[model samples]
Target: MRPAAPEDEPALDAFFGHVDAEDLRFRFLSAVRKVDHDQLKAMVTIDHDRTEHFLAFDPASGQIIATAMLAADQSFRRAEVAIAVHRDFKRMGISWTLLDHVAEFARWKGILTLESIESRDNHDAIDLERERGWIASACPGDPTSTILRMTL
Candidate 1:
């Protein structure tokens, strides 16, 4: 996996296009049928300092198979992280590896905390986060969501 670049927009879009609807909803925390070009652009165009995106490639196919995003708050003390792996790539430890990568990046960026706001229905992701030592709590205003946090 490596940091995403502007040139990766098309590949990122294609990757999201092939992702399952449920996976997209888990990643975005909403019912998104499709990831628009503008949104894809925003993801790939990273500032590196505050917001960074990373993509994991299929070694054999050279296609983007997973993505991780880290967005730090204005104070640079806390950051939100999100990750998604292709349907075919699930259960291969890809998500775990990507989460570790993002956490390392967050620590290097001087972030004190890393958080993931996940839908309540995304039990697999929440479980994975818990396995990685993140604390899970119900989101205050959103009963449908859970917040997973780790202090770096």
Candidate 2:
């Protein structure tokens, strides 16, 4: 895994394109048909101190297969974490490792809490978060979604 640079936009776009549709919905909490260039640029043009993006590449193909992002608030006491792994790369422990990495990164930045907002239908991700000791609860007034929180 490595910090995402502006030049990695194309690879990031391709990585998003390679992700499953359902996974995309789970990641964005929307029915995203295609990831636009502007969105890709936003992902790559992060400010490392408050917002960090990381990409995991496939050793054999050298293609990006997973991504993790942590965005902290102005207070820097808490951060929101998000991750997406390519369809072909699922079950390879990519998400697990990325989440772990982001949690450690958040701690190093003095973030006191890490949170993930996920769709209720995303059972696998919820399970994984639970396995990592994240507390899960329903998102307020949103029956279709859930929120997971981990205290650092």
Candidate 3:
């Protein structure tokens, strides 16, 4: 896996097609039918100091199989993280590895806490995060979603 760049825009667009629609909604926290050009642009063209987007590539095929993004607040004390794996790559421990990698990366960047807002129905992700010591709480005014937080 490597930090995403502007050149990765096209690849990310294609990668999303391989992700399950439900997973897409989980990643974006919305019912997104398709990713647009502007959304892809915002992802790849980020300031390295405050935001980092990572693309995980399959070693054999060299195809993008997953992505993890971390965006820090102005104080850099906390950051929101999001990740997604292609449907074919699910249940392969990709999400676990990516979460670890993102956490370590956030620590290196001086972020004190990491947060992920996941849909309440995403049991696997919530379970994995809980096992990793993340605490879950209700999303303010949004009963359909839950906020998971961890301190690095």
lDDT of each: 0.92, 0.94, 0.94
Off by over 4 Å in 1: none
Error of 1 at 61 (Å): 0.9
**TM-score computed on alpha carbons, candidate 3:** 0.98
Residue-level lDDT of model 3, residues 53-87, one tens digit each, is 99999999888999999999999999999999999
lDDT of 2 by residue, 1-152 (tens): 89999999989998998999999999889999889988899999988889999999999999999999899999999899999999998998989999999999998999999999999999999999999999999899999999999999
Give the candidate number with the greatest lDDT. 3
The TM-scores of all predictions, comma-separated, are: 0.97, 0.98, 0.98
Instruction: Predict model 3's lDDT versus the native.
Output: 0.94
Say what the RMSD of model 3 is: 0.7
**Model 3 stretches with alpha carbons more than 4 Å out:** none
Q: Weakest 10 consecutive residues, lDDT, candidate 2?
A: 33-42
| Candidate 1 C-alpha lDDT tens digits along 56-143 | 9999999999999999999999999999888888899999999999999888889999999999999999999999999999899999
Of the pair 2 and 3, which is ahead by lDDT? Answer: 3
